[model samples]
Target: MVTSIASVCLSGGLTDKIHACAAAGFDGIEIMDSDLTVAHESPEEIRALCERLGLRIDMLQPFRDAEGVDEDLFADTLRRAREKFRTAQRLGTDLILVCSNAATATVDDDAVTARQLGELADLAAEHGIRLAYEALAWGRFVNDYRHAWRLVQLADRPNLGTCLDSFHILSRGHDPAAIEEIDGEKIFFLQLADAPDLNMDVLSWSRHHRLFPGEGSFDLVTFLTHVLRAGYTGPLSLEVFNDTFRQTDTGRTAAHARRSLTWLADRVATTDSHDDRRIPEAQCPHAVDFVEISGADLSTADHMLEQLGFTFRGSHHRKPVRLWTLGTARLVLDEQDKHETPHLSGIGLSVDDSDRASARAEALGAPPAFRRTHTGDHELRAVASPDGTQVYWNDQPAETWTEEFTGGDDGDSSGAVVDHINLSYPWQDFDEAVLFSTSVLGLDAQASSEVPGPRGLVRSQVMRSPDGVVRVPLNLAPPTAPTPPRHVAISCQDVIGVAERARARGLQFLAVPANYYDDLAARFALDTAFVDRLRRLDLLYDRDDDGEFIHFYTPTLGDVFLELVERRGHYDGYGAPNAPVRLAAQRPAS
Candidate 1:
């Protein structure tokens, strides 16, 4: 019922980590033995600090290589286990983590291993300590969690229970349904971690690639559901060993860890044994109501919108904002002091309830975004993303807010709508952005991609709503790299017509090299006439079994660009294969 995190998940000294965990609102922490072993403060001082901070030492980890060894090694192991037991007693934590022997275990007999563990448990019981046996993915014999539980059952000691780690279970593709077979009280501790689908050694992946709950590929909700069905009532603790988190700021990592638990609690509330564990519910947005771009002056962007046949709706009466419309698509140009280069600063999502969406976002550790409004103006409820981009939630119709503007004509737009938004985040904040978008906006993360760019590979994680009304491709760039330009892709019923109108209005399109068209002709079955047409307009094309995609990009306006796309039939992709051509073409401006 409590939320906790392991000290190995963060970067700092033992004292600093305890303070950060408490500040981040964690109930307890699993202290790594290595941290305490090299600490300046004594175990008594560390325990006093935890008491002062209102934190509990949930467990002391880890006493490794204690079982499945020779009798001589077992003698030394028993000595080591006794000292760890005393240390746990001083730290005020009654549980110690016992990972399965990864090396130096020649005995393949389960009875011998279980008997040794029982003897160790006997030693722990003398100090009023419990042992939570865990399986390591790289363990020599008992790599699976079920095997660890089997050993615990054979030991039949009240002080010896199994600990379930999500990484070890899910990474090995073990059936979690088997967890329901173990007695709930015998599940002494639970550790959760999410990791990406990798094709390397299990040990390396476990050490370097662990991510927060919603930030990676594992299905933790279902895994926890089975544990709950078994009636386990221990703390929901994070035990992520990530290379990135270890080097990042400790406070930020701790906060990120807490948010993951918040998100996960809300997700598993249906199966949770306790009602108080649930957070606010998340509602998936229906559509992107509008995208707001801010810059010193967006005059060039205004011209680009006009060329694309977007009708000028008008300007805000009390603020420096203008609205443009094309069918269901809306774009807002804010003349703010963000930068000289125009970039996406805000996004408006239409949901069932704006207030509820905001509540869910706030619960997941997103700070409120700043907005200015008068007495009569429609209030925009929004939370800022990790990269400082505002995500506004709206329950009212567009007219309620658009009516505040008065000036230009509302002309026809030929049913063009926003297809997706491409947002760029620095590497340090990329994972946070992923979790924020998924947990707050209720978007499902699709398969990630790496596109070859002029500088390096551009990693794009696509987040899309269930109804396919919204798609956001989060692009990651190195922190030291220049800020990547953002783009708004508008889906038109007829991109050729839109492109022709923009061209006639004197808008310069991004010039695609003729070599690209040559490659397209060699790839697809398009005839010469269609290829020539696409080549003449400098447009890019992609086709899959479902349908075809025809898209073209506009020249960069400051640091923002516009893309017009047409999906023939059921093409659901964002022209990822053609991204390299677009990136190469925009390199000079970049």
Candidate 2:
């Protein structure tokens, strides 16, 4: 399918947006009228630039409040349409998007709206331009696609057809199955956007909170399936209006948008019986093989790992990297990168077929990551995520890499495994990271929650594999705070025992406030002795109807930290209710 994006979805000037879209592999663009009007280049020059970049100006967007107006207002609207038609001609595009009137429509009658649209269509036909009427979710009169489609049929002009925006149709809870009933020829253009469900004004939500497909809660797969069933073969354009996307780097945002379309097309093709062969089948990883941290000095990290009962599994035979293990948990510390601070830099996932996973990631626009390997080392296929984290896919045993360690697993096993990895992203990269986790890694994004932080709210989303073997809890801290440190949480059968052992080994755990224990005792009605034991060990406790959770944290090590957790019964949460207290404890004493 041909992919396109609206110029308004990205940051920067019209020229920058065009170049970014082209570089990101978009086949066409919906040039917002304001973007073109404000460009330094003339329309002809802009058109030439798009042509040179191998991009088509698919549509000139947003001639708003054009129909269902008074007679005099209709005359003025017609003049505005004529001006837009001239602009469209110069921009080398034939279609202009006319959003159903949101304001200034005195005549709400459909007959009048249809007649006025017909006249506008006749005028557009005279200029050899087409008008794609879109029903805004908050339109003054025509707020539904069906309503807009009826008007388009009533107008009955070849130059006029309906533009179905996924946001408008889906956000208003309109039945998209009806779209299949409409003639494909009458459906002029399609704009797609996904959004998180929010209880807010529809107009505000549409304009500010829309996310790219696969990044939000919208059922875009089913949405696109219906559209494809209708036999509509137009460019699948993205028209997201996100506050974050508007301020991010234009090229990066454009690339992220392009990946969304590629992912959506693949999903639609796979879900339906379509013969499109662009994307490969998704490879869901079975388990996390290892987590790699890199730094200039890892002495402190080494000490902490030892205190937490992780046995040193020896350094790589060739590289300056050391492996530590506790049961199934593997932590690789790479001292090869001497310039970087301690950070969780890479993750290795065990999949049935590493090559297939790598291929799928590359197909979805992930950049392949290069790693130097010795003759004895296992060659891992890796890809760099949007935030520069390397994700590696490995075979189930990964013996090639595991056997390279010389120590031969001599140290005591702690009986702990990686429960989850907490990764923090800047506000700008949060959504992109979500998409990457879903589309490239084949993880499912669960419902996101906002945890209270000292500075502000921290949005957390958990992306996990189907069998719950691999879980990545993504956190987005408020921009005002310093970037949140990434952490790895290891789960033990007895966290109390592990905490005591670590304390005896002289590892300083993050102190919990006494008031926190008092509140927990009141909240969960825990036995006083249990609460006292938790407080004494600096542990946090949380429980739900299903089960209970107990966890504690280590002091931050540069930009990384560690957590030991114990989950009882069926407890699936990450002790979210205690996050504020944990944050307070992690904060430096004011």
Candidate 3:
């Protein structure tokens, strides 16, 4: 199946992020609720930006602590949900993420939580929206995908679905194979994120240490294989919440995301074709529809997607990340700089036998300077790509490892299979990149494209193994947009609630125009009360059968910004049409 990423994984403010995702080659984006909260933009304005950026708000996420609360708290949450649903209807979005009750939630009853969430889901369905129930890495209860799925089953609401997050699921040492037993329809959204193997708690790790896929110990290929085998055919959104990525350059971060998704897609191709548990290609879902990459240098990173043979999909020119395309999969590159690497950093893979797909990379020549670490279910090995980029490969799986050590199945899983990689090259090295990828790396050429921008046009290429099992994209930008920036996007159920909380928490925000909403009311026949409420909250919107997609914009620090969104109906796209409005909003007041 294809891979995707959540925008929260990246760093940067909303206005500049859409450009970042488009540049990174991601298929779709998961708009974080927090990002939108930071932007005091109206719903119509936000919708206009997504339309301009050519991105789909695949899932509006982060409905926090809705379940298992006291009646007073639950009622408050219900009110918040209603507001979010209203915002979702304006933004043309559909899926709302309801995460497991956090430590702040006092109730310890899973049944109560399930009932509460089911009630919310039923209410959401009335608005043509679905709630994707998720388990946090440090949730008070229901931290595992299986348990969360069971909760959804128990809820028995048609509007309730499961969100399979790689970090929460694999980080807890849970078996991804449980995916094989789940019905694909029940699974609505798949949020993918990876982290280095470290001796830390899941909560801290998720918030502080999450890296891009292939940069950590999670066996995404195996995990996704099980997911696809279960008949899941949805976008796999990346949701890395790292501190380092928050401060890096925006373009570079976007490029890293493009490369990571390319790598994950290749790994999926190899893993799904394995003989031990091979499934028909038709049974499997399409490759990643979108991804969110985090780290600095996002702008240049987006330009780098061309090197990987990814096309400029589209982006929120006013947001932090850019979206790019490699075949059908989408990659979103972000640069949060959350105390993470500042260079072209991500996970990488290489194998000796092309037949058996290796989840971790095997050194073809001399091993580079690196070390290994252990997480809950996997082992991570770090190495440099041909260009001396920092890339990690997970060497172990959960089922085969013991409590103390992690190891890889070199015999069965190791072979000369290349996962995927995205790398940046100097403008002068553009031709050299082609030579290096095709000759030195012995990879087959895939496709090539160029993108235009204020800076100028950028060029790129993709190289894959002869069997098309492995892929890599190398990118080069002209002198105009030389530096990359950091960016990120996150999905959530309620943008208005997040915005209210963020404001209450004393977070600064970028403002939008009231005139935009005045015009919006004339175009769409929305409930006047809802329109007035959105205008008062400064939320933005767009519409489709998927629902209304809502968004917000905020400030940037160290190349990082945050995005928040809500999906109400069946909409799956970045609000591209909102670009001009967002850009104008970002402009200094006259």
Best by TM-score: 2
User: 1-590, model 1: which lDDT tens digit per residue?
Assistant: 58899999999898989999999999999999999988999888999999999999999999898899989999999999999999999999999999999988889899999999999999999999999999998999989999999999999999999999999999999889999998999999999999999999999999999999998889999999899889899999999998888888898889888999998887888566556777667879889999999998898889888888899999999888999999988999999665557888899999989888988888888889989899889998989887788999999998889998889787464778889999987777789889988988899999999988787888999999988889999999755566578999999998988888888889879999999999999999899999999998888999999999999999887778889999999999999889989887888653
| Clashes found in each candidate (C-alpha, N, C closer than 3 A) | 0, 0, 192
lDDT of 2: 0.90
User: TM-score for each prediction?
Assistant: 0.95, 0.98, 0.50
Which residue runs does candidate 3 get wrong by more than 4 Å? 1-3, 274-590
Q: Each candidate's lDDT (Cα)?
A: 0.90, 0.90, 0.61
- Candidate 3: Cα lDDT at 9: 58
Model 2 regions lying over 4 Å from their true place: 411-414
Which residue window of length 10 is worst by lDDT in model 3?
A: 279-288
Error of 3 at 541 (Å): 66
Across 241-263, the per-residue lDDT of candidate 2 in tens digits comes to: 99999999999999999999989
State candidate 1's TM-score.
Answer: 0.95
Instruction: Report the poorest 10 consecutive residues by lDDT, candidate 2.
Output: 407-416
